[model samples]
Target: MTAENVALVIGASGGIGAAVARRLLDDNRYSTVFCVSRAATPPSALAATPGLRWLPCSGSPEDIAAVRGELGDDVGRLARVVICSGILHAGDKGPEKSLEQLDPAWMQAVFHANSITPMLWLQALAKGLGRKQHCVIAALSARVGSIGDNRLGGWYSYRASKAALNMLLQTAAVELARRAPASKLIAFHPGTTDTALSRPFQGNVAAGKLFSPDFVAGRLLAVMDAATADGTLSYLDWDGQAITW
Candidate 1:
């Protein structure tokens, strides 16, 4: 990618999102960085970055529209789009109870946060990708999302929603191959990080297994930089090891 390329990162208030923003800024590959989040302000570090612009709003239609307005018509083209927005509502031991105890409201909320939000982003920004060159769109996915890898299944809503996100991304990849011809849509597993979302369950993880946000962000950037337009839907660990399915 050129130095003038622009990258949009959703959920910029979170650990992963903030780290990714800093990494991108440090690389100097992108001329402009849009940090979108529901919070009114970005982290101090991100705010201090020269090229970073905070778009403080939720991932709602109105908020995205405001972002679009700020970007205007002459954005040239977007080189990368990263969706880091997600939620981990199901508790530590996985989904608290069996189907009998599951609530529809909770399930729907999980799906909305994990799956539907990404789809909305794609719908809103697909047309903004630069013409006649490969662009990357990556969404953070989990290995637990892989149906074929589900040997120790639990966390029904979280797992299922992430699986649905994977499916949506796969389908979008195929369609973009035919339509855009120069865009790659990918779903990545960022591994377990030492963030609030993963803290509750870190008890089960071996010592030193939890990654820092900086480490995960760097690896994710490396993967995105190396990805090509060819259909490559990978679910991998932090070390780049492919997860089943």
Candidate 2:
């Protein structure tokens, strides 16, 4: 990314998202780093990281549009767009391990957070982001989303929602190819990072297999940096390895 170019990082509140935003700011390559999240303002920690400009957003159409409006003409200078928002659980509800445990309400929440919301951001930003010579829209996805790679079945809603997300991104690549052929769309899995989202599930994750947020963010950036827009969507891991659809 050029010094005059801009970068947008959605869901910059915590975990892997926060790490990526900080990494970008620390890189000092982009002229501006617009960080969006549900918080009323940017976190106190961000003040320590120079070059980060937090733009408060609720992940709504209006908010997304507001963010677009905030960028104004510089929206076209968007070099890299990374959407790191997602939900693994909320309230008392978590992923359903069995079909009987599935609740439509819970499933809907998962889909809304994991899949639909990210699309809304894409929808809002797609037009301005279309002008970049080499832009990449990287959405955080899960390997569990891979229907082909699923040998152990469970986490129905989580799996299905992420699978749906991958499909949406895949379809978006086609549209992006038409509107912005130079841009690339990616469904990126950050691996099992040590975050609240993976806290409960960490028991099964072997030692050294669980990665830190910084590690995952670094790896993801490396992959995105080296990757080219080949007119197709890519489902890849933090290691830059391709995952089956």
Candidate 3:
């Protein structure tokens, strides 16, 4: 860990988010770890750790300033920023199985969670990144979002929102490359992680397919660390292979 390295993990209350934060802490690669979540209180370990900064607010763009306020001058040291928050279900609604199941409100909420929320975080942290550092900003996207892989033709809202996320990530990468040049913006697929978000759908997952949060976190971070050195944005799986858009 270098004195100047700092890592930011948003949605730090969720399973994957918390696990990634813990992994970063154990890796000792960053002097400060900024954890943001909508939770009223931080996870227990984060609350107890030194050099861990917890910011509580709605995971929205406007609330980013509150986190910025807490981060003070530390934002410039950012080397990695990971967005781990996204929704697959709410109330009785889950991913749509057909066009008839689509609800406008649910679709909107999914879009905001999967795409807009992460973009807002990027907007908040994009400036002041030191030009000399190799910075990577990754958003957890889904392979099911891949248009090339879709064959069954279900989960309309989720598929569309994630596809939208890929577009945004790709476009942002182009601009960041032109400006920051050293920074990499990537859309990362965590697979069917064994989290509350995927719990209901896990019954049908093939053996060895459902992954623990820590496992996914480790793989994703490894990919981010190994690939950002190239300074080109990519949509990659946990194994670091490029995903079709």
Highest lDDT against the true fold, candidate: 2
> Ranking by lDDT, best first?
2, 3, 1
RMSD of 3: 1.5
Candidate 2 deviant stretches above 4 angstroms:
none
Off by over 4 Å in 3: 229-231
Q: Say which prediction, candidate 1 or candidate 3, comes out ahead on lDDT.
A: 3
lDDT of 1 by residue, 36-107 (tens): 898898888687778888888777788777777787642446787789999886453245346675677888
Clashing pairs in 1: none
Give per-residue CA lDDT, model 2, range 59-127, as digits (tens).
Answer: 778777888788787778877889998988777889888889999889998999999999998888778
Please count the clashing residue pairs in each candidate, in the order shown. 0, 0, 0
TM-score of candidate 2 relative to the true fold:
0.96
Pick the TM-score winner: 2
Clashing pairs in 2: none
- TM-scores for candidates 1 onward, in order: 0.92, 0.96, 0.95
Cα lDDT computed for each candidate against the true fold: 0.80, 0.87, 0.84
